[model samples]
Target: MAKRIAASLVHAIETLFVIAAVALAVALLLPRLFGYTPYAVLSGSMEPELPVGSMVYVHETDPTALQPGDVVTFYRSDGAVVTHQVYEVDAEARTIGTQGIANKDADGSLVHDAQATPFSGVIGIAAFCIPYLGYAEAFCTTPSGLLAIIAVLALLAVASLLLGKSGSRRAGRRARGCGNDG
Candidate 1:
């Protein structure tokens, strides 16, 4: 009964580990393939709606479908990417406009021209946002972050190899003992 319990415990641990690994891998890879980019809110431009340090998952979409109050990421005329709320969208003229919530007046110029293509021009829209998750995501995407992950994986591989060797040795010893008794 004790042996059975031990085996069950080990199996449960292994299952949990596998589940965690799969979840982490999926979280990291899903965005890259689905035209989603996660961003950390760095400013209070869209205050009362999205705050700084918020982790937002943005998905690319058609510019024409954008509506007022929709938070979006767009390329400015100066070529800098900015995330703000859409204040107006002129479907007839093909212009997409935006403004910061805290700003006293609307932006001086339209952000996206009517001729602007769809998601071809958009980076993404927020699908999910968690406050303070940006730092962790940013750290994981850095050069040092990647190296740290590689190092940990290598360590796990070595540890698994050692554990497997020990387990096999124990199994062989048990078999030998049973044969001697027989």
Candidate 2:
């Protein structure tokens, strides 16, 4: 009974570990796999919900597909990127009015009032946001961080190969022990 209980606990632990590993892999790969582009917030314009340093995932979208209240990212004439919620959409004119959640007015005018963005200026529609993830992303792109990542990947590959070899050897020994002749 004790041996059976121990075996069951071991199996449960292994299952949990597998689940955790798979979840990590999905979290790391899903964005690129699904065509989502990540952008980091540089200002507090979006405020409480999407604070500065937050990372947002945006997906390519058609101009006609957007609706009021949808958050989007687009470029200004000077090529600066801005992310804001859509205030209104004019399908016929193919233009969109936007305002940052935290922004009230810019230079005494309602934000984006002077120039409504044309469809061609739209980059992508905001999909999701993760606060502070932008810092981690920025770090990972640095020279030292990239080297550390490569080193860790190499270590993991070596460990897995060694573990596989050791496991096979252990199984072989057990098989040999069961033979009639040593």
Candidate 3:
């Protein structure tokens, strides 16, 4: 009974792991194939709709095509990348005003200020977001995280080999008893 329970537990774990792996691959890789750049959310500026630790996929867009209420990602003069909702667009000047949802004020008090990041600084507009996936992306970049991933893969490989051997042994035993039903 204990052996059966152990086998069942292992199968359950393997099934869950496979499901998670597939979901992650689709969320991370599928967007890249379509010209979407993925950014990990590091702040709660756009909270409620886009919580922190989410993975926001962005697609390149024309500045003139942007309108109020559109979410955009752009770089500041200091090279800081920011994602915020468009508050206004100045076609003649080729700049857009943005503000965080959680903020009480727009990114800049004046449209001509740093908050009005130029069209040239625009990286892209956010297409979609996957909540809490950014944590996985951040963790995977660390040395310890890489080691942990390698260890898990190794364990899975070892488990698969062991399971395959046991399955073959069972098949062999059944074949030997096929004509010995006396």
Candidate 4:
């Protein structure tokens, strides 16, 4: 009975580990698989909806297809990427005016969207945003985080190898004991 319970526990753990590994792999590859770029938000300009340190996935989109009320990511005059809600789209002039839903600063007290960003300056349209995931991205670049990832992969490999060997040893013992006992 104890052996049965132990087997069950091992099976459960292996299943959970596989599921978690697959989920993490998919999340990491999703952007590259679907023409999306994950950009981390560094400011609270688009706060409340897209809080600071969130990760937003942007997809390449035709600027002409953009319309008012749509949120977009565009390049600023200084070449910085900024994501905000589109307030106006001028197809003739190939420009878009965007504003933050909750931005309040010395440069934004005039009650208007930002200067019309040129269509050529548009980077991509915001598809979705995951809050606080930017912290993970930052951590991934750190030495500790990299070491942690390596440790996890090594642990997984060792666990799988141990499980495989134990199972094979049990099978061999069972085969030897299969003969009739006097």
Could you tell me every candidate's TM-score relative to the true structure? Answer: 0.57, 0.58, 0.73, 0.62
Candidate 3 or 1, higher TM-score = 3
Ranking of models by TM-score:
3, 4, 2, 1
Worst 10 residues of 1 by lDDT: 110-119
lDDT of 2: 0.77
Q: What is candidate 2's lDDT per residue for 1-182, written digit by digit as tens?
A: 44345545555655665675576446546897898878888888888868887888889999889999899999866788888889899998999998877777656543654578999999999999888877666667789977976776675556555655655666687888953322
Per-residue alpha-carbon lDDT of candidate 1 for residues 1-182, written as tens digits (9 for 90 to 100): 44445555555655675686676556656776977777777777666677776777788877878888788887766666667777777787676666767555365443443334234456656677767666656666799987986776675566556666766776787888843322
Best by lDDT: 3
Q: Rate the local accuracy (lDDT) of all candidates.
A: 0.67, 0.77, 0.83, 0.80
Candidate 2 colliding pairs: none
Deviation (Å) of 87 in candidate 4: 0.6
Q: Candidate 4: where are CA atoms >4 Å away?
A: 1-25, 105-114, 142-182
Q: Return whichever of 1 and 4 wins on lDDT.
A: 4
Tens digit per residue, CA lDDT, model 4, 56-137:
9899999999988788998888888899989888999989998887766678562445478999999889999888776667
CA lDDT, candidate 4, residue 57: 87
Which parts of model 1 have CA positions greater than 4 angstroms off?
1-18, 25-44, 51-55, 77-80, 90-95, 102-121, 124-127, 130-136, 178-182
Model 3 Cα RMSD, 1 decimal? 4.4
For candidate 4, report its TM-score.
0.62
Write out the backbone clash pairs for model 4.
Answer: none
